[model samples]
Target: MSTPVLGNNKRASCGPGNGIRQNSLLLFLLLALASCTLVAAQQPPYDVYPEAKPPYYRVRYEASGKPGELIFPVNYTVWIPPQCETLRGVIVHQHGCGEGSCKSGLTGAFDLHWQALAQKHDCALVGPSYEQPQSADCQMWCDPRNGSDASFRQALTDLGQQSGHPELSSVPWALWGHSGGGHWAGGMVMLHPNRVAAAWLRSGVPLFEANPDRKSIQPHELPEAALKVPIMCNPGTKEGVTVKDGRFAGVWPANQTFFAEVRGKGGLVGVAVDPLTAHECGNQRYLAILWLDACLQARLPETNGHALREMSLEDSWLAVIDGKTATAAKDFDGEPLSAGWLPGERIAKAWMQYVNDTNITDDTPPSAPKEVRVVDGELTWAADADLESGLARFIIERDGEFLANVPEKSQNPFGRPLFQNLQYSDTPVQPLTQMRFAIPDGDDPQSHRYRVFAENTAGLKSKPAEVAP
Candidate 1:
């Protein structure tokens, strides 16, 4: 497998020790490696991906094995919100390089957190899983110019037709990618910036200047038109920020170069450091969703086939490059082109919270469950997720009295508790959260009624939806 750029390989430099010579140095290096390994192990292993159920359609392509073409088979899964007459765009949740990340892509469309953003804007969610083995060359697929670009476009065409939403092929896109996937997403933005509304690259970016060392890697040129699309570079603090050694430590430098090159040119690019992680995604989806949502609001066209609206920077917010706090761009004391540009004030605050730690909060409660009814032996309902905070769990009420919570124990191995169980890739885990609760036994069929209430991660609860008689 083509490993990502290890900007720095000295484990001691990125970890606990600065200068230790002798047995202590060996111990420090060993501990540093162990620490990185431990953090990565916290995420679930890539075993097998789940099946694509209803409302979720999938298309697959085989490797052509021809020159300059995708050499691996790939599966593209798409989820279109129900009752949608048309689609505004598609959100691409591209996973990083490696078997685990590739498999995680299969569940990207199933993510309720991301789905909330798409559903709110009437867009489709797409997850593409490239069937590359652990020992294969990741560059074969991570680099969009390496044939995956053609495959990506083709998938949209097929998905648009398969989902009966032919507009998907022509709609704009909001991209969120991890690691090598980040590289791919950023590349797409550079190549097709007009169609891309925005992009969030977590620990990856495309090369602005060509590297003579990499014959297989071709550099992308910065186009004036591409500056219209907003982009963000996210890298872990350990990746050459706080720590300067270890695997993936190069992520920070790569992101830095990308940010400087783009931001220096007055491009709408920003950076957010993941203070609590190395390469693993630790609660980044919260901030990413917020940014993309704002971009969609400002960029999406008013009508189905109209051109995207232009976003002016006259009243935008700005923060010091890689700084935690943000304020009005006009008041920014630093150089205007060098400062990080935020969509607005709301996102600026959220970005600060995320940079310190992924502790973003939501004040308002989620909407109450709708169309509550008893089906067979379970009480089912429909609900939308809170834009600020995602759905945590449901309160099963027996005649207005609290009975139980769907996930009795609310937990988020990656970050804030979520009903869908957020994974490392910002996607939901297998066996996605259900909106149905089993009917408690011992209640007479005609005598007992049920009400379901929605709750967000912030502990706010919504009004109850009573089950129909």
Candidate 2:
């Protein structure tokens, strides 16, 4: 089964168009990426082992996509925590090479294990199968196009949407895979680091040969910043059997090579070497969750949230705001609070709102160009236009001038939020005029400073605001 490629009609088009046209083209490309084939209309609840009496189980919504095309069907299994309201995190299980079978394949035993894990962690587990090939053709296994990265992503996305837990957005996620699934886990770490918080690979093969250029250009290459992400490799003590000539052949290396590679790159790599164990699912899983618990317990920095440094308009700098002790955020609403109010405070509302919208960008211009203002207890800008449509880019200006252009689609220098479809959520227009930014907080609040600017096509820039400290 192959990942789904979107129909041409679903794609964007352009013919000698301007910035707006170009932006549309970008949107099209992003949407085309949605071709990931993990589509199964969620079904009503049902029992898995209806006849099993009190200890019952069921994979509620299990269905393949429209038949015909290379159908890489992924099963979406939900492991609801006993206390759904107070959830810990999301766990994703990627299946390895096997013909589709819930009983005999990776999906079978994992469904039970995932459910147990979810119960233990007070979270949810979603196991998705990325085309576990029935045959191991060298060409097929080696081809990047043949991999299940897209299907895996789509599966995770579908799970998130259906689970309907707002906390999932905040909760971290761990990627677990065995054998071929492990290889895909590596790909996920390299390609979608922003979507995953950590990963554990159990006896998986290296899908890609390590190359310097591929390391740099490959969309899935591990980013330098991702060195912080935790990784684990639990290769079986015994070598895995290599299939040859349509038969199970010789054995391969039992060493934890990928574990070493990840460790070399400054990642926290866990290794459960040769523990008097056989090459089976049970052993691999034990190592996976043990590593998960350790990594998930750490308190990570809120790189993009409210706890970060604040931005000030004075010199286009970001500062940290320490409001930890406040019952609720101190109100700088109607009445201006001293020290925190920065230059771009006027446009801060518009900028922040644009970034947080969890929907596709309409790519339209703001209708009523209203300046930023603090209304009620929160900051808000009353723009008459469709504020959500315009393009947004983060401007890193040293002294009221452009320094480097950072596309929002750029990797989150951290390993969390793997498979992040942040780009798909909002279509950003290029050459933005008026811009807003959040201020970073720090131990010494006075040390940070930054400003926000709104630029127009006439080369006119909006007055910078002193971001509230």
Candidate 3:
């Protein structure tokens, strides 16, 4: 082998020891650089998001107990991703009692609503099915202590432990459920006020009414601490009255009283009463999205008005594309919707069904004959009367055939007057009609399956009214 030349340097050494030492040093330096990069990547840019990942994690867990003696087979779907700089937090979904314990049909019903939230808001969603025993005393369908609630809570805890994603550790979370599930959600919110941030109760019984005047009704009683959070009391107008004797008790006034109590405690309570829908995931899906955005997006404004009062009609609300309220100037109606209402530019095109769909507007007109017209490629309607006078009821009709009606009971935009925990001396209001429905897109306006009607206290309803195409 030719001798290696050392030009103006130390003698060149090809010894195995020197070669090995140089290689080792090079490898060590490479690893150190890689380690530094990893550490930097793992560090979240904000305090809320301390991890390198999205802040939430989806998971499933089981209850550690026997199967028959009130053992509820729970199917938990958890969502709390890593690295959430945004305050929009987690929301847990509780499924209604259906079919068997841990069955797919019952759990699948929640997928649409839960998945929508997860994809839209970048938040986590956890859903659990409560498996009630077949025993006569432990009917899982309606029993509060039938292990459903406990199973869900356990899944939440287990998910938090396994997923090293730090956000679920103490982030704000809301409980939402429908029908039977709504019952559980309400109980959870009342029972664990400190653990849960707030709740959205849909078509469920209020806790206090289970045993009025009983101090033991602690779960239903609103706590002072809960005032910091919110609980949206939403009931579908088309839920068909509470059936007692094969007949409808109509909308229970007691439910309104419960809302009043929660509101009286300075809690955020939004009611979408008499919406253009019924007790289905579609209704919950739309409402829950808005509710979740409100609860987790950021701080909302303080209202000096009655918490149980209806939102105004004179206001043109604005919000983020995701429907979160922005801090903007209020409208003439004193509504803050204009502040944070941002519509997604491309959403209208992508989900034209939502935009084109003829749904009920939360705004109710002042006492005047309302007119319907399709304006600027949007189905728009205008009424000149206050909501209470019945001159502006949100009516549902199809193809000139009367379908349903949501009568107005007050001057408030939301129709019904705010029950001030006391009776209203003025005209215990009665709605002109109670049927509520909506027209779907792709339906013919002239021969469409449904149309909306507006009537005044005089029982005079609009004629051949159709929203703009």
Candidate 4:
């Protein structure tokens, strides 16, 4: 389904007539805000969901414009962690342009893996859907200087009041965006650098230089303030010139220009090229989450509300390409590299493994399910959580025969499968702890044997726990 695009009504007259119309529009917006406040006060806070599905909190805010003009509306959905009492920051996962990606925004907040990251940092996960049609000008909202930025700030205030957390307006932001959404995220950092903790721009960035041919996109100015924010530019390898006529060919040039300008200005920036498919997000989150985790730990304040501690460069390592092979560089000496300044040794190793194979290399499996018992065809067990990749799902086998998988959910359009125990879809898989699988009734009860195996997001399966009936 496509989001309806509302058109603005223009006045034929200029001069005094235009002035009068502008003033009327401002008055109308004020009235609208007041009305929204009244309605919000009467509405109850949205409940947090363990699985992906509807019933999430969403608020629509109109961009500022002349009265009677149909301003673009930005629809925002926020997922607050059920356990977090005080939020430290907020992570905004923005989708690309077009109908499919815009619709994907509905599920971004429901992602369980992102929720885990947010929960660890006491942050809220939010997604914004700009109601721009497929053929519409993406610059209308992607450029933060436009009214979308104002609408986003307003939405935060509205949600803060609705959720009874007024501090939401003051907390820092960790932005993660794809395609045109990347342009939005990157633009946001440039516009409001101090308020942002970090940014991950995937396959898109706002152009600092204006192209006379493309006037639709207003060029953004690179401000000195943005130099402090940590940013990462991730583009697919296939999007480069090597592909010649690839569909996403523009991605590499944009990333190169952006990275050069930002890094040349002494900004904290890095580039991590996806070795796999072009334009498709494949196994990037495995590194994205870890990178964000390190950035947040180094940037966020302690419990007493002190200044953030600086990240030590000495602890970081660089990964560079030597001929056809990938090599780790302990020293950073202004050399051309693939991944520059990995946070730590573990992350450095993970980055190397990822770049070399286009997947996270994790041989260690999750802890096996414990106390597995079957009573009256009902199975119950508990498994130790895998701290590395996080638990994806549990494999159940009956007498060495494949049985049902717990919490069946569909995979997201992104690379992650639903069975991976991550939120790729709007509906999340039910928690494994609360899951109960019914055994087949026709099976021989005495001769039946059940085995349970825990799988991590890396696709590693743990040792099985066997139970005899």
Candidate 5:
């Protein structure tokens, strides 16, 4: 993984002594407690609007019954586009097991890339964080048959009332989950197939074969209804096939078993193996977003509040092609299968690129900024938007060292901004032609070499344009 350029904590030049460290720790604890108290006083219990800058709301729900039991509270967050008049569908991004992955769910709704797709399709982006601890068994929530499913449904209703988008309770869903969250997503599709438009399972799936030895996790049944929902199983190459005894060894096998059973029964399922790291989500979103975009286009109704359009086999390409060197259906040797399902031409090509390199190679970057200038502590530039992926954000550097990013305040909890239009005014908050940033407090603008690099939605960084010191 690439080291994060910004936000790395730099230790103080003069290290504090043990006594000072202890006092500082105590002060920090007291401040944290006071902050928590202030926040709780401002809002009702179980409700928290995360520090994300986006116009979204989050609510927490405590697990019912005992305190020391397996059950834990679920944190649900949803982002509705400011321009949306009437909702059409919803996209749910679920995280994996463990405290880290679950907490990572806090950023799902704020993801600009995911939000872009949802915005285009008039769908709301929602994320559910099941606060299962590190030591707890994932099955308690990963399996939709458990209390997690009920929590998810209830969250939708509660968030609907809170966000004033009550229609969210009834919209069809496009589900994406990573690791154990993948198990939950797949389980939800199987349990409520009619309500799902599509599902993307990344590196995890519910086991269909009965394991008498591990009876705690009951095997899930594959009903005919589930066959209607389009599903994709994406596992990393190193998980099982390449590294036999790795920690994620079971990932590929679970995906294979589920794919075989579902496809064998004429279920709409496909597998995309990530050629990169095992378990870690790397460039998977590029293809995942495109695939869901295609599915939502086919399944969602153009008019709001109407029933979802029935998916048709004829609308999807059905060809069996190797992920590498298979762009078009004609690229394959055999004829397109009658029962097989595939995405549109663009998405299919992207899937091929994704599986081959585990990265989407977009050579084109956003147009370079013109009329670049620095005044006092502020730097300003003008540039046009990238026609393909659209402009994501800008990177600023001083003397080739990472300085800051444009739109300094994080657009989402992940500390990245979508920068797309927020209000119904149908225009971006800051015009692409105009961007400004304040120099760091310690940096001397007169002597430093400042440069700006534009990043697109595909996460590609552009050639830097230097500003005269």
Candidate 6:
């Protein structure tokens, strides 16, 4: 028997048998309906993302039926390092508005590069995807005051129950947001100052004064407590700096207003301009991670359920509004309070490298790949990413001699080479970077002892990891 089903706006025609009984036809129709596939109910775009296995947890929420709640369904994915008895904080990688940007959040927790940062601080990493359509008003969710704040906290509680890490709900959050996501993170800093360790706003920022052009944007007041959280505003130079008069021309101006308002009020905020591209997130995550790492190191509460540590201003670094690089506070001759505020020396150097060009150089090598094993004709291993300079590729050796490079060549078009080519979402391109090497068939397998070396984007190589022969 043939059945007709309508899906994806297409309909199929079914042929009828002559003189068929109406009751039998109805029964046949029911059977056909039961087996037919409906495209209308198809899984969402986010479903294509990688699965959340152990050490990683995921939760989904439908819009609450109550009034004034999130009008769209939301998904939250979290990753926790294995063997951690307790967690210190949660680092959120928030995406911008629109379906394409929001869908990118699906793979956020699975990004190996980001996972390295979370693991180092014993903090959980969270990616939240709100199923917002292209036409929806962004302010509804981007402004956390619009019910997302409550929903996010609820998800944390729910995730804590699911992952057995109850501390997830109590720990402070280090936020990294792009575009509309930046609005949410900045607003959170304004709303719950004590709960935020730091915030990095890329390409978008919440306004301190309501703008006549954007009447819907509710302004947030800077409370005294909010002034202490380390904040960085990153916007592409083309947005307004270098190439003005484009779609993103207002981005830099908005960022400036946000920075000025925050910094003028004793707020620990600074601006880092992306000198390369505009609108699109280009090489911003690299700097964002570096800044957040420093913040987490200096600010994560010493004990769980405690207030965030205040950053010391003595060791601070200052950079003039248009300076290429920052100077240590001690050496700077400018008015301390007027310049951009960088947390400390390490971040100051990194910030300088990032603002001048997205080419951040690393002096150290990545950690060596470990647990190397060969199965059948393939070799596999594990490695930790170089937080300073991300992993680029792996060098394979046979009997201490060069065999081949895993990814024969680098493919990153954005900036420096990276192992898993970086996507705009700050995630490694899908089908995660293969740490596997195929043993050449022509060569005698038994005669070869394999070793792999981790390579960073700076072209520095790590000590080789050998496999048992």
Q: Model 5 shows how many backbone clashes?
A: 0
Write one digit per residue (lDDT tens) for candidate 6, span 1-469.
0111111111121111111001111121011111111112224333355567778787776655455576666778898989678999999988777656666676678777788899999999998877665545566677888778887888788889888999899999999887778888999999999999999987778777664544445778889999999999887788778866645667776777777888888889988888887756677777888888888999987789778899988888999865687999899897777789998888888888888887776788989999998888888998888887778899999888998997888676656667877555465555556789888887766777888999987789999899854
**Against the unseen true structure, what C-alpha lDDT does each candidate score?**
0.75, 0.35, 0.38, 0.62, 0.64, 0.75
| Candidate 5 CA-lDDT value | 0.64
Local error of candidate 3 at residue 415 (angstroms): 23
CA error at residue 333 for candidate 4, angstroms = 5.0
TM-score of 1: 0.87
Residue-pair clashes per candidate: 2, 59, 41, 6, 0, 0
Q: Write the per-residue lDDT of candidate 3 for residues 145-200, one digit (tens) a residue.
A: 54555555444455666555344444545677554455566666665665555577
Model 5, 1-469: lDDT tens digits are 1111111121111111110000111121011111110111111122222343345766676555542232666777788987887788889988776555665565567555577788888889897766654545566777777677777887787777777889889888999987777778999987998889999987777667765534445778988989888888887777776766545666666666787788788788877887776656655766787788888989887766676676665545544422454434445455344223566666666777777785565667666766678877789886555544556678898789887877554342221234442211111222222378877788777777889988886677778888844
On lDDT, the stronger of 3 and 5 is 5
* Deviation (Å) of 158 in candidate 6: 1.6
Question: Which window of 10 residues has the lowest lDDT sum in candidate 1?
Answer: 13-22
- Tell me the alpha-carbon RMSD of every candidate: 8.6, 25.3, 25.1, 11.0, 11.7, 12.0
Stretches of candidate 2 off by over 4 Å are 1-71, 86-88, 100-116, 130-133, 136-147, 166-171, 205-220, 240-256, 299-469
TM-score of every candidate: 0.87, 0.43, 0.45, 0.73, 0.71, 0.87
Write down the worst ten-residue block by lDDT for model 2: 14-23
lDDT of 5 at 177: 82
State the TM-score for model 6.
0.87
Range of the 10 consecutive residues with the lowest summed lDDT in candidate 4 = 14-23
Q: Rank all candidate structures by their TM-score, best first, as comma-separated numbers.
A: 6, 1, 4, 5, 3, 2
